[model samples]
Target: MLVKDMMHPAVCVTPRDTLATAVRKLAHEHIGCLPVCDGMRPVGMLTDRDIAIRATAQGRDSNEVTVREVMSVGALCCSTTDPVEKAAQLMHLSHLRRLIVLDRRAHVIGVISASDINGFLSEPRPFEVVFYKEVLDHLGHTHRSQLMRISMAHGTREEAVRAAILEFEETRRVNHWNALADGYDVVSVRSNS
Candidate 1:
């Protein structure tokens, strides 16, 4: 299947739109993201996660904050004619649940969400998770960086995400694993699907 075959009409928002307005559209559409467009071209993507982390968490007034303030810049896009496998790969690598589908003219034509990909993730796959950490040095004056990577095979993405955090905290002997509260990236180590 191709992206164009499965993509639905994109519901877009402008950069200057307020977060409150965007949230309304998202709720009304029952969608997690909206393509942020300038005219017909997609400039960015505003996701529910973005709103929660960038605005709500920061205690900013949603009515005063603009989409451009919290929206993720440089929205990943796939050509409408591209194969569904390509879309799946992009989403898997980027940790995005949807991607903007563009036409030949580089116009926002529609959106291809994970749900739109037929059986793309029906089978189980091993995912690699990397945790970046900052630890205090022996002097207690400097911060040192460390990282750990783990492989997990969970039935669902949500399960994989939670499991990764739990495993990291337990294995690393850390009290809290708050770094991934916003989100984290994972790569499919192997896929049998």
Candidate 2:
């Protein structure tokens, strides 16, 4: 699969946007990060951790700081058409869980992360099984059932399922592995949708 197949549609912030604004956006949108953009061009990425480390930890008022102050400038990104494995490798090497997916003109297109890879790996049939059983065994029945219902209702299987897992992780749904496991329940139901 390629980055385009896995990344989400562009969701970005502006350089002038305050760290406080970015935090609000992240919380309101239920996202962990956002690409800093200037007229469709991605210049950087601001993550929750960035705010925590650079602003909160230092006792700096987020409202007084701009995203440009704490954002990861010139973030490592990949093209939409790039192989998924390559993107995963880059993420691993860069110690970044998320990667900004770019378009032909280098505009932000989507974002991919380790969870996306795990979601892809969980698909039944032709793909290799990376963490399927482990996921199911951990999440159990109730939570898995809820995830399945959401996935089936939306008809989002691989990439979308991964995105959901990532969201669950941010919401502190037990653990990432448990979230991944619950994601399998959604994947199985989504296939029938």
Candidate 3:
């Protein structure tokens, strides 16, 4: 499936928004990330990690900060049509857990993460079952190892694997596969040609 298929629409933040407000929204909504937009165009992304690392780490009060202050600029993104595997690979390479989905003109359309993929895996579908092997194979060694580490650290193999996979998807490196399958046929052909 493509990012557009699963990404959350109605993405909720802009650069000028205050960190305090963002935090409140996040807490209220129980979400961990936000796409920072300039009007309708996405300019960056803000996450719980950015606030903890950039603001709290510096001893700054979140209440006084702007989303721009702690937001990651030039945020990794994916096109709506990009393959799910490609998104996963990007996440792994960048060590990121969320990615903003964009449209043909580079406008923010939605966001996708490992969580979405996990949800897809849990749902019953014939196509999903068939593609499962392809999905696993696309998640390369580094990605797999990262997932294992997360699993070990977090105490749940399933959750860890999902987190790792989603993290990579969010970073824009969606080309991962299970070791057994070689790689996605389309991706391999594009890389070679």
- Which wins on lDDT, candidate 1 or candidate 3? 1
Per-residue lDDT for 73 in model 3? Answer: 95
- Error (Å) of candidate 3 at residue 84 is 1.2
Better of 2 and 3 by TM-score: 2
Better of 2 and 3 by lDDT: 2
Clashes of each: 0, 1, 27
Report lDDT per candidate: 0.80, 0.70, 0.66
Mind giving the per-residue lDDT tens digits that candidate 2 earns over 1-193? 6678878776789999998889988998888889999988889999889999988999998889999999989888889886565677678788899988888998787888788787764454322212333323454643223332222122335655565454445434456656444334432432433
lDDT of 3 by residue, 89-186 (tens): 67878988889988899888788887777665444322111112322355453322122211112224444345445543444245653433322211
Question: Once model 2 is optimally superposed onto the true structure by TM-score, how far is the C-alpha of residue 107 displaced, in angstroms?
Answer: 0.9
Best by lDDT: 1
User: In candidate 3, how many Å is residue 103 off?
Assistant: 1.9
List, residue by residue over 1-193, the lDDT tens digit for candidate 1. Answer: 4689889899999999999999999999999899999999999999999999999999999999999999999999999876565677779989889999999999998999998774654544477666655556678774534466655545466666677777666544667776433334677766545
Candidate RMSDs in Å, in order, are 13.4, 12.7, 12.3
TM-score of each: 0.61, 0.62, 0.60
